[model samples]
Target: MAKSPMDTLQLSYIQIAIAFLLFAQAKSTTEHTSTPQPNDTNTACIASERSALLAFRAGLSDPANLLSSWKGDDCCGWKGVYCSNRTGHVVKLDLQGSGYTIDSDSRKVLAGNISSSLLGLQHLRYLDLSFNEFDKMQIPEFIGSLHKLRYLDLSMSMFIGRIPPQLGNLSNLQYLDLRSSYQDRDIHDGTYSTDIMWLSRLTSLEHLDMTYVDLSAIVHWLPVVNMLPTLKFLFLTSCQLRTSPESLQLSNLTSLETLFLVGNQFHQRSTPNWFWDLTSLKYLDISYNGFYGPFPDEIGNMTSMVELHLSANSLVGMMPSNMKNLCNLEVLYSYTSNINGSITELLHR
Candidate 1:
């Protein structure tokens, strides 16, 4: 049927409009398909993290059904597993309460020897192996290989022998807790250097807890720890430091927040002038020492201080008047001291 010119033009215009709409729809679909989906990538990474943990368990000969419940496709369902919601990478592994027993044949517990298998977890940041027995196990040198590790809690684990100097290789390590209630008291001579020069390598270390570690000669090297710029928390309880450093210079650690020297022999007379320079310190505890002196007047500079403990010392002086500036001060313990201060002032402030 031959149509008129007007009919033919109208038909051509309708076909052109339909073709344009179809082209637009196709372009939109292509863009939507090409765009990368971050959620899918994260899901895949999370699945990989879970598989790595499972592989780690499988590599160990667990005769005692220790990690039996760790089976499943969902990583979040497993115990002691924490995944970052944003990146879907495993961030924390708190396996402290898991019932992992020692193998009767090897006399070794699961996850005792830090192996390359565990080290394969590149995204892992926090690892808690406390309350587990890793007795006489030489810390895997590869543990220092974890570049992303930030917090490590090995406390209450029967880790014997001198600390591995290779641990200084963990540049990102911030918190290190190595306290053990039943730790070996026999200090292996020549096993570890009292100088601890290796500690200087951990530039990012902030909190260091070496409670009950044999530190007879380590007191002399305490000043060297001042080289760490980010160091804020220091715990040396029962370290056997006979006297505080004569210089007591830690001025570089401007970020220092907590200073604990409990159960040391740092007498009051040995306290140096630099002790007052810890302007950023918020918590200071030097109890169970033979310290005897007036609390430094510069205590007022620690305006951010919240807790202060100077108990079991021979401190003899009236509390400083500028102490009122410590608006955040909450807990102050000066018991067993010659400190003569009106309690009313502190209570009112």
Candidate 2:
């Protein structure tokens, strides 16, 4: 049958409408399948990791109810626990306390055993239990088994006895802080490390702080510390370090920015120190030591120094003329009696 022009136009319109409907239907089907649906894998954490965390919490005495939220199967939802979004694996456990303060009540901090059950967390990378009470127990040797650990902080905790050498097994560790508080300094009951040879294994270390930890017995401590090429911030205040023999004349701390060696036993010595080679130093504090005699002219070499502390020492003699080269210097702290000559010449530089 021969159709008229009007009939043809109407047929074409019908065909276009049918094609549009078909396209819409196919698009809706793809959107339904391709869209992300609720999966139990993403919402629920790994079963084995959850059990490990529960066991870890069992050994702790949470006086402040810090672990009160540590209930239910989803351990990821618990306090101070973080899980990987993709794998649902536990990666970090941070239970840092407010530290033992004179004004705060004893019930405010966590006190008890750090369970060995933490070994079950194979993927764990970061662990921090600083500022808590551990009943003066030694650090567990089993902690060395966690090979994935990158950050470990036990500072200001009431741990006693020698620092476990097993901590050296953490080759990936970047930050290690074990600053402790002593119950009795006379008896040396606080954490002490006589043999720190294991420290050389931590090649990736960047920041190390061992304030208040007795390292006087370790005569070769300086050389072992120099092994860390990436170390930037080092704090060894009140560690009873000695300043004799001058084992290392030049430090390998190319990236070292801040150094604190206050309250050490560098007694009655005018010898040249090794740290003067660190021209990159921004902050240096060597106060409260037994250093005596003339201040070394080497101080002028550290032009990058911003703050220099030489207080509480027996240093004497005039300021070095080269000290005027410290253009970037901002703060200079020293005992006035330590300076003998006129400061007008150095100040004008």
Candidate 3:
């Protein structure tokens, strides 16, 4: 009375199904057990960031209520302190315009200075210290150590020192604003160098603002910016650029949309032929310079232009007849220039 082959096969199938179910259950249990519970990385990183902030606060004579709630017990909830939810790493620390007072009697405001402790923010990405007073402090070279930094704003901070070439090490940097910090008197020491060739290493930079920084000696440095193919918004107002290069070409910066060169000294020269080739340019300002020459007939090539400012220059020529081709142009400023052209046609369009 041997069991049929079909019955034996059925028994084996049931055994195999049970074994498979048990193995799946065991795997699920292991995964549940091995999953890492929330730990100290987040806590430690937050603490470190807070500690850096506290050090900065202590260094200041007065913090002007900007750091009122920056206590250690509940640092994660501190204002202007942003931490990663999962990893707890501090990523953003914005302390702009803190308005700290120096002395009780004199009540002189102590503008924020660059604290070396801020370099400890290993994961910091966005830092805005603009509109504060750095009191003639030099930008700390340690800032170059922030490998993960992407956006930095030190504009209007009153910092007086040579631009740190080490900033080129920030390969991930995308936005940089250092405008209006240095005054005309700051140039007496001749510390400013036109050797900004290190800026080419910041290939990721898209928006750059270096207005009013006394760049008269660095006319050659202007062309070097073309190396950054990713540059989109460029502001170089009042930089004392004395001339436009004959071979000035920026066709590679196809993504450029906004360009500001107001109050630069162009030495009364012909507009560079390459200027018409920027097909992506939307906003352009070249006002208050010495650009003297005929407007290029190919000016219409920049059909994407929406706003164009060329006022207060010594340009002498008939306006290009092709100017009517700029259908997208909304605002055009040619005042104070020797531009001769009938405006009736442009007004009609």
Candidate 4:
């Protein structure tokens, strides 16, 4: 009985999407049991991509039969599909919901009609329909025409309208989750999207989640996500964004490492100093924000931070005793903050 913190951040986003479907089924079982050649053959899965995955299983609503191993002539041996053993084709299609039952008022979801026959796989590259139950459809802009997508998860899967700006043409995306909090939704429940400037052409983006997206009138959204020079894990939690950025020049973002701006608008947009130039931050979530004064000291210069969340902020005085230089600090979340320091010299440094 202890999973809050948004259910531990949605079970760490489904354990990083089941560890990316166990690394794409261990790279398709090490390319068919590695090191086995003798004119090796076994390339099946492409009868028009197994009839477009049996017309995407006659448009879902599977109520837990779990696609019954998707019956047929080798969809690369079905079951959450994954092909590509030297071009068998259909590359990864993890039907997330982890063996079913992701309660959206659980009638054991897997709801209907998301056809377009998945644009016929076309050498698909990892697509997770997160926690199935597409009742609030409309996210299917032909899935941005697939284009060799590199990991795309339709989070929570209740998908409603307006997200697809043709997904910025995929640009070989690197992990992009369109998060949704549902019911406690944003963009007035029509699900949001305000021209993410096509997410600055992806630029090989590395892990970006639009948490409860709304993007509050994206004014070039922090210079178009600082032109994503291979960004590393960034989640815009409850994005009604206003994370103060009249330029602190976050150039090339120093290969950022996990930064989630939780519940946005840092206390009327004040907590900005360009996040201490992101010294390779290691998991820093600005929790349920609206942060007000005093807790700043450039966050002890980030010293390779390890899990720090200023929970339910409105932060107050005394915490920056140079945070004992963080020194790889672990898990510090101040709930309903009014931070008053002296944690026994910060727990003996």
Query: CA shift at 56, candidate 2, in angstroms?
Result: 1.1
Q: Which window of 10 residues has the lowest lDDT sum in candidate 3? A: 30-39
lDDT of 2 by residue, 120-184 (tens): 99888778888888867888999989999877888878888889999999998887888877725
User: For residues 1-349, what per-residue lDDT tens digits would candidate 4 score against the true structure?
Assistant: 3347886677557544643453344335333432122211376767888898898889887877878888868777777787777767777787776424555445444678889888988678777787677867768888888888877878777777679888889898777888774736555564688778888898987777777777777765877888888887777877777756634554787887777776776465434557656878877777666767778788888899876767666778788888888878866766566677566776677
Q: What is the lDDT of residue 11 in candidate 3?
A: 46
The CA lDDT of each predicted structure is: 0.65, 0.77, 0.68, 0.72
What tens digits encode model 3's per-residue C-alpha lDDT throughout 1-349?
3446786566446433533343334334432432223333345445666788778767764445666777755455676666666677777766666333354543323364567887768887777776676777766678888888877777777777677888889888777777765547357422254678878999988778787776766757756788888887787777777766565543568888777777777765655645556789987777677677886676678899987777656767788877788889877766657777786776578
Off by over 4 Å in 4: 1-45, 60-86, 92-124, 128-133, 136-150, 156-178, 181-210, 213-231, 239-255, 264-278, 281-295, 299-349
For model 4, what is the error of residue 261's alpha carbon versus the real structure, in angstroms, after optimal superposition?
2.3
Question: What TM-score goes with each of the models?
Answer: 0.71, 0.83, 0.80, 0.33
The number of clashing residue pairs in each candidate reads 2, 0, 1, 2
Ranking of predictions according to lDDT: 2, 4, 3, 1
Best candidate, TM-score-wise?
Answer: 2
Runs of candidate 2 exceeding 4 Å displacement? 1-43, 244-250, 341-349
Q: What C-alpha RMSD separates each model from the true structure?
A: 24.1, 23.6, 23.3, 18.1
Cα displacement (angstroms), candidate 3, residue 17, comes to 76
Clash pairs for candidate 3? 268-290
TM-score of 3: 0.80
The true-versus-predicted C-alpha distance at residue 83 of model 4, in Å, is: 9.1
lDDT of 3 at 275: 56
